[model samples]
Target chain A: MNISLQTRLLLLMSVALAIGVLVTQQAGRYESRRTAAADIDARLGRVAHTLLLSWQVSNDLTVASIPALTVAPPAPDGKRLPVFEVTTFDNRVLLRSHDFPLRTHALRAAGPGYGNAEIENTRWRVFTVIDSQRRIICRVALNEHDRSLREATLAPHFDQPLLLGVPLILVLGWMSLVYGLRPLRRLSRELARRDATDLAPIRSVDNDAIVEIRALRRTLDGLFERLRHAVNAQRLFTAAAGHELRTPLAGLRTQIEVAQRAPDAQQQTHALERIARAGEHMEKLVSRLLHLARLDSGETEIARHTLDFAALVARISGDYARVACDGVDRPAELQGDASLLEALVTNLLDNACRHAPTDTPVEVTLAHHDHWLTLHVRDHGPGLPEADRARAFDVFYRGENTFGEGSGLGLALVRAIARAHGGHAGIDPPSRDGLCVTVRLPAAHRS
Target chain B: MRILLIEDDPILGDGLQVGLQQAGYSVDWLADGALAADALANDEFDAVILDLALPSRSGRQLLADWRDAGQTVPILVLTAYDALDDRIDGLDGGADDYLVKPVALEELAARLRALVRRSQGQADNCLRWDGIEFNRASGILSIDGQVLDLSAHERQIITALLERPGQTLTREQLASRLYGWDGGPESNSLEVHIHNLRRKLGRQRIKTVRGLGYRMAQPDR
Candidate 1:
């Protein structure tokens, strides 16, 4: 059962209060009983003492044999009074009368003492005493059926407090609990009335409670902030993807129209070539978009392994030499995931190749420092404006005069991969001839 | 022009077939890439309109196979997805052109004409006639050293007519050339534009094919 927090909290508090009140009530009842028994025993012993001082025990109702003179007349029916055995001071039973069972042997068992006892099957209390000089043992017993009447006589002593004070204590205890938890109730009401988006801390006069509420509010606010950021990023990506796809679609239409009007074989071939180029542009854009989406969705679980940085760079450069050999000169070097690195180097070199004059040289160099590996691609092309350098890495970012069709996710993907690998990518200061870009990867030890 | 159209969707294929027939091209339609490839191997087609998502074998793969086998017939790839990466991949696999779905019939016909023109290596210039000639790229019309500078749109209209010299082009077709799907001219705009062109180029330069459309004539200067 998924118990709500409020219900659980209330139940816990209620259980604690009940246990506390019950224990206190049990203790108070036990203490009152002890005090009452002690008082009854004391009074019975006093009566026995008075009888011993004034008269002697006899087998007749002389002035000394009067019930009040004879050990309080065996507790006077319903009142608990001393019970005694009168003999020739030899501890023999002189008289034995009782409202409840008063054990005469209690005098012998007590060795000339008195105490209180309860009768088994009857609601009674008994106190016994002995007087050796009077040759009498006295016991006081009382029926609890008339307890209220007897307690009325002792009301001035302990009755008022015991009878009236217990319920008052319980009522006061309940009020005290309610007062102590007032701050908690206030916090609950404040939270209950709040909207889901309301992250403000509940105001409280109690410092400790306020601090806890503030901490909770901070955590919730932080989570909402992160959620907003993620949603914004998704929106930006989708808009950029749409714009990137539009240009190629427009280009395709133009290519097809040119091909349709081709009157001869040669014109048709030229028109076909333009269409092919447009198609090639479309393919790369789709793949790049999918790649970015995969990375953004955190679905890229890149396999990690030991890599030879120099070897990887040489291999990529060798592969690029086949494609880029016709133009400029040497191929670009790169070191990273063979597939991902190929895409990275391809995009960079391709960007340079499209923008730079065919005669200008594009150079790539890889260098390793203390704990970093940096790959630099230099192109003798019109470099990006210093102002546009930052915006260059944004998805679908296109420069002013880039010639061939491009998706514009090349640098964005490169940036994402760099961050994923705990590295960084950025544009460097251009040489007099053209632009330069440097990508730095943390060495294995640093990583 | 004999064109092979490999489209899987029956509605689009039927529409394209009827449209191409109306536009004066012989169109052979196939629903499967494999059958299209087979037909291409056995028969001669001036051009091929290949849908990328064809049954049996994908259009891209068919184009690749045909190109690998040295088939030089112009292949125009058609697809629903207009993604750049998909376009690039299609072209890279040897498709001559890529077009998206829901294309206008006139636009498709124009594209086929362009593709055929490109395959012939014809530049966008040099329209020849009886002793008079028009150069579209340079916007110049020459008749025995009398050079006339024509506006770009006039040159485009003349060049379009010169593509099929004596063939009729409806007013709607002329309007399509002037304005794309968006921002078309107002009513009777094509006639007004043609009248202005005829007055500048001389009345005999163009002929109105009755009940058909307009056409450029080989003038007997």
Candidate 2:
């Protein structure tokens, strides 16, 4: 919960190291016990072999007369001593040590093997060796409790390496983690040092960064580039708007002054007429600007409905009977926001009329193919250059050859409206002489 | 005085044309920058009023081009761009004077007059000859401290001749000044106006240079 990357990594490393240490310690304990038990068994087998050889050398002697064979010596500090015994194949004791725990029967009835036995309520590890030529079996045993106590005494000696190595492992793990995250820290510092307006991409190198960090840096750089473009566009839009609005306002002021200064009723009438025309231009400009602002803010709600595209174009073209006409008569229906569609058509028509020569008629064509309805508005005017086509839809971008008083938002608004209806707008290359702006939208199924 | 007005906006251009015409200056208006540039190259005018944002060519580019081409007609820039940088750019780009839009008609007229006077190497707005002082600002002529009422056509002829005193102005030049290139006066209208001017002021006050033109005669001391 709310843990930093470093802390989480360190915690995971510590837990893993602790488990490794525990497993190593447990394996060391088990191996040490096994090695000690194996050593005791080998020693007991050697003693049994030696006892059989001794008995063969002193054949025909009485058991009481045989020297007391000290098969295993006593402990130096008076601990319990190891026990040994020699027996015949028939299970009769032939020789035995003085401190042997069992005298009524041999340590084991079987011969030539090593195993565990219980004697006088204590457990012992016993080994037996047999001499077939002498018909004798010799056995030696050690207490299980004593062997376990010896193993316990030697545990810390084996654990000394583990005790010193665990902290070193943790330190190394933490260092690697810090070193790996250094790039991330640098990225954060760079972000923190930046001002709000600084949208420059972060510097990056190919070889120095790991893959993950490099990916992160690349994504952030992309974001910065997008933001910078958006900001520049916004700045351009505002400047263009200020320039556009002020010119008309200036016209209004100058026209009013002209009207006031008119020497005669005729001149006054002409000035007043110009004033009215300027007011209309300004009104159109303001409304278009407000529409663009709404689109930019993403605040306008679009209500979509199924409508006949061909019929809509035909009806709207009638409003500009002299300049516009629908080229097709078929029912090409589509689903879209109707008001926005009307605005789109109106802006296109207005743009064509404004740019084209007064006598040239604007052609509106509609076609349906593969669930798409395409609306094309073509004008017989000097079309935009290839270089200007790309930026024609950019807000307030008027081409160099363009001649008119325009708000420069007509094409941009058309594209915006088209996009809102899940469609797109583009300018086709001039085939002969003129511009053909095309809008493509999804066609509704016939019902 | 004849002035060339270059503005792109229809309403503003129309109003400036009417207002300047009423101010007693024969004005030729072009709404396209390229056309205005061509007109400036071909025609001679006392001054030019230019708008910056124009069709086909920007006014700034046209001004720079005209200056490069050694056209010395004084140009006054009238634009809606009032920012400091825009003003600096306009002035540095060979504009004679810069005025932001929403400009008063009187101010624009005064500035145009001043630009014209400065270009003609005159320090004041008064042109005097033969005891008649022409007030360029008021478009009025006063003799012996008494203002004389005159028709618009008579004012145009006197203003044109007074700008260059003692110089002969041909009938065609005076007729163009009075009624522009499109509408020249019909059936010796210039003679009729001259007849009326000779009737009002003393007949010898104007000299008829036969087969050449007319000039203002010197007054006796």
Candidate 3:
């Protein structure tokens, strides 16, 4: 059940207390009652022996049959004392105690053992024994009302302490637990007081913190530290992105202003040409940013479709001159998103065209082997240095000699599109001075 | 006036240089921070337009180095970082002024003129002699109350002469002021400009030295 720890503990302790008290109470009552009853029976046997001795003495001395004396009634104050009787063998009553107006066969029924009898509507426990030497019988009895195992003395002693201890133990247990859990409560309160932007580490409230509490605090501190780093990194990245975007914007504005205030037609034309270049640069930057954003955000699902890979490459490479497509006539089919695939081929061609020398031709090679399709785009331009080969696919990483209009996102987007189709892209050194990129995709036949 | 433009971006640098040059200030461009620092140490510029992020070194480092060396040339920081912390740091680290990118060319020119004037301790932004008035901010030349139209080359030459009315300047010095580190027409062009100026202004206003180039005549008190 969804219960608090304190309440749950209290509930379990209370149930244990109830069972403990019940067992002890019942066992005590049973033991005490049996002991009291046995004690009462022993006293009755002693009294019977005493009475027989006294009667035997009186009968042997023949002292006028004990002078027919009458014992005084029991001591006052409504106590039903034990009663006794003496009788001869012929069923004659010699003496009796607890005097009653009428007696009916009290000494004649039981032979020589303890028995129960009703005399004047009062039940009695009778211990009857025969005195052979005195030729008489002696019987001592106690009424059921005078039984020792009543609910008076032991009830208060046994039940009162346990009943009172319930509240005491509950309150004390609850208080001690609250003290032990103080650190946890303090931590929660401190967390609740923090603002959303506050990622500071939580501090220890005391010098002697428990190990569990200390461990919890350490975990929380670690999380907050990571969050702080992430936030700072995001802020820095946004600032960098803003700076990159604004530089081109500033260029475009300055060029437009220059054109507007040009002194002559030739100067105006020069400014306009720069302005057009600035526009092109801005367009490339923005489109690259959008592509990266879309890829990161997972907004565009990679819709799988079967298409001719060779045909796609040929169609995209049609824009660039001196592009020789080898092994591209066959219908090399693969399952991937059409639009994303189109973008992928276009970016590969764009990178090749930008890097390749004007007169040299860009080479496109597409081939399929075993359940995989491989495509290569090669350019005979200044090959990238080995040091820059690894990070060349990083977004916005422009090479040292790179100029305006190179957004530096072409290879990065190509790799992203290639990976979305359960494929990989990598760079390979060409035979001579050029950059050759290779992409591998799972062919449709694999399925 | 002349300006040194230190920017890493090719398109922005080329455009800003052209705009500033067209506004009648000779502009020299540097694309690397180390080269910029070296040029500032050797040559003279009326003002400097610095981009904060650059290759070889950062603009802030150069600014600190220049300020530490007690160079009093006015520096205007032009950068794409619009953050408050960046601005505060740039200004507090010895920059004469700070501006975010995408600034209007006219505003940039005006700020540069103001920076130059302030460094020269000219409060009214005007230097007057021989009944001729020049406003640095507008690059406007007027005589007394009437405005006078002059070509860009003539305006530059006369403005330089007006700043130092009693000092004679050589032809190379004047040409260097009009075109910094870049080729201009030959020395005879200076004489043609001087001829054009003498035609517009009185002959006595521009005194031609035999060996030295030219000087504005000291007005009679």
Top candidate (DockQ) = 2
DockQ of 2: 0.53
Ranking by TM-score: 2, 3, 1
**What order do you get sorting by DockQ, best first?**
2, 3, 1
Q: What digit string (tens of lDDT, one per residue) describes model 2 on residues A1-447? A: 799799999999899889989999999898778877776777677777677777778867777786556455667864455677777779777788876774435357444688777767777788877777777777777787877766766677778899999988888889999987888888788889999999988864642458888788888889999999999988877878888887777777777877888878887887888788889988988888887888777898778788887787887888885555554588877888887788888888878777788788888888889989888889888888898889989888776655568778899999988888888999997799889999998888766
TM-score of chain A of each: 0.66, 0.85, 0.69
| lDDT (10s digit) by residue, model 1, range A223-298 | 7677667767777778667655654554465446545755577756765676676677778888888877776677
User: lDDT at B161 for candidate 1?
Assistant: 79
DockQ class, candidate 1: incorrect
lDDT of 1 by residue, B49-129 (tens): 987755457777888889999999998887765778989998888887888765766777778777877875766446676
Weakest 10 consecutive residues of candidate 3 chain B by summed lDDT: B212-221
TM-score of every model versus the real structure: 0.52, 0.81, 0.73
CAPRI-style docking class of model 3 based on DockQ: acceptable
Better of 1 and 3 by TM-score: 3
Find the 10 residues in a row with the least total lDDT in model 1 chain A.
A322-331
Tell me what TM-score chain A of model 3 achieves. Answer: 0.69
Candidate 3 structure lDDT: 0.80
Q: Which stretches of candidate 2 lie over 4 Å from their true place?
A: A53-81, A89-95, A102-106, A109-112, A119-121, A204-209, A260-272, A290-301, A308-311, A324-332, A363-378, A382-404, A422-443, B18-26, B78-93, B97-218
